[model samples]
Target: MSKVLIIFIKNPVAGKVKTRLAATVGDTTAVEVYKNLLHHTQNITHLMAADKFLFYADFLQREDEWPNEQFIKHLQKGNDLGKRMHHALEQVFLNKYKNVLIIGSDCFELTAAIIEEAYLVLEDKNIVIGPAKNDGCYLLGMKNPQPCLFKNVSWSTSQVLQQTISICTREHLNDCLLPTLTDIDDENDLSVEQKIYFKLKKSAQ
Candidate 1:
């Protein structure tokens, strides 16, 4: 029974990674913030007992903190967010991973425990989603590949979580919901106790 974790991320370029955050803080600050998020995610996921795959949003980084021995890197395919996610999961399922989980690099509250829990929930539930406190979701997992959950849903909108739930209900898929967590999308999201932390830290640096 092979389990796999797929991480979706963009290259941590100055003006590319977190556009909304960049809008609030300058581009350099946004880059620094994104790098911190990446480092945090990498540290947590590195300890998980599963095959890890890093799907870059655009190009692949051959020389980075993600040591080549630990992660199998690839470029993300498809035309939109939904299709790209579906494709990544689909490829892993095709590669024979029974338990598959996919996550983005935006959620500050994501922990190794939550990821481990997702793997466990997939033991019975057909799907598990870690909903963001805002309009989107942070993590999505499946016992087996079900690309239907990624379809017919709006991307980058406040209604994403609701729309995904509707699709799950319509498809009759048994879904488990994890505790909602804060995802860093805009200034308002960081204001949840993290704005001060990030700002002060940036000031010192």
Candidate 2:
């Protein structure tokens, strides 16, 4: 089946991204961390064979790591996170793709292999979800737009994953769950080896 991968990201703007992390490490450091996360996402997703789309929070950037010709870039629509996501899915589904998956850049552990596996699972199931350790989901995949799954969601809370599953159950949509991974949100969320906050201290000055 034809597949599409949607990646949601913000252009690395200091004081504008990762607000929680910014609170702990300051805006300049948060921007750097987000930049690193975006780089990691680009590297991991570069090898995938499916059609890829980068949904930007603001305007598009052509000079970034993701070559303009390689991934289709679009600005995210709607007023809230859930609405934006639902709109993207609706638009993609209207285009007649057989399988679609959306992921955020927050999960550093996400890999191309896991993404491929989600697409594979979509061959049988209508939905595939990768649960995050924070009770939020890292990745969500589906064959068609199921708008109910995106509604009434408590974004950024510990109940996100559970609420999504409950909606799925209510709708009787067949689904498969992937392994859980941690998404960086707070300063404590970063692994010691990945700590590059020190690098931003000088720039912030």
Candidate 3:
């Protein structure tokens, strides 16, 4: 079974990435912070044993200078947030990966071990979710593509996680929830980045 990691990212342009954080930290700093988050995610994903890693970006044609060899970069398709994620997952599964996991670039606490755990959970569970502290989800995994869970989801809101769970229940899909995690979306979430940075800095010494 091939394990796949799909990272949904945005062009870390000023005033584009981390809009909420931008309000607090200024657009330039927010973009820098967002870039750090993306780097963190890329580093962790590279440490995993996945057969394929897909970096799906919002703007298809806008090419920023990211590390090319880090992952397979692809432009995200679909109208809304939910649809884009669904489309990306569907394409990856259609291409023949057995276990696929999708994640965002904002979770500073995401580690190789957590990703490995999600892959393991997918061995027995149809759907796996790593819930976020803000009532959203940082990671979602599946044995195969299931579009229903991503359909009609209220994206960018507190109801996201609940709506996903509701969809799972409505469709009778076997689901597993991993330990709660945090994503850097607002001013409060900035602490997560500091903590991760300091932890890594200490470990490096």
- What tens digits encode model 1's per-residue C-alpha lDDT throughout 56-172? 998999899998999999999999889999989888888878879999998778999999999989999998999998869899988877877777788888889999889889989
lDDT of 3 at 36: 84
lDDT by residue for model 2 (63-89), tens: 788987779888899888889899888
Question: Which residue pairs overlap in candidate 3's backbone?
Answer: none
Over 4 Å off in model 2, which ranges? 196-205
Candidate 3, residue 72: CA error in Å? 1.4
Clashes of 3: 0
**For model 2, what is the C-alpha lDDT against the true structure?**
0.88
- How far residue 37's Cα lies from its native spot in candidate 2, in Å, is 0.4
The global Cα lDDT (0 to 1) of model 3 is 0.81
Error of 3 at 53 (Å): 3.3
* Deviating ranges (above 4 Å) for candidate 3: 60-67, 192-205
Displacement of residue 158 (Cα, Å) in model 1 is 1.1
TM-score per candidate: 0.94, 0.93, 0.88
Tell me the TM-score of model 2: 0.93
Query: lDDT of all the models against the reference?
Result: 0.88, 0.88, 0.81
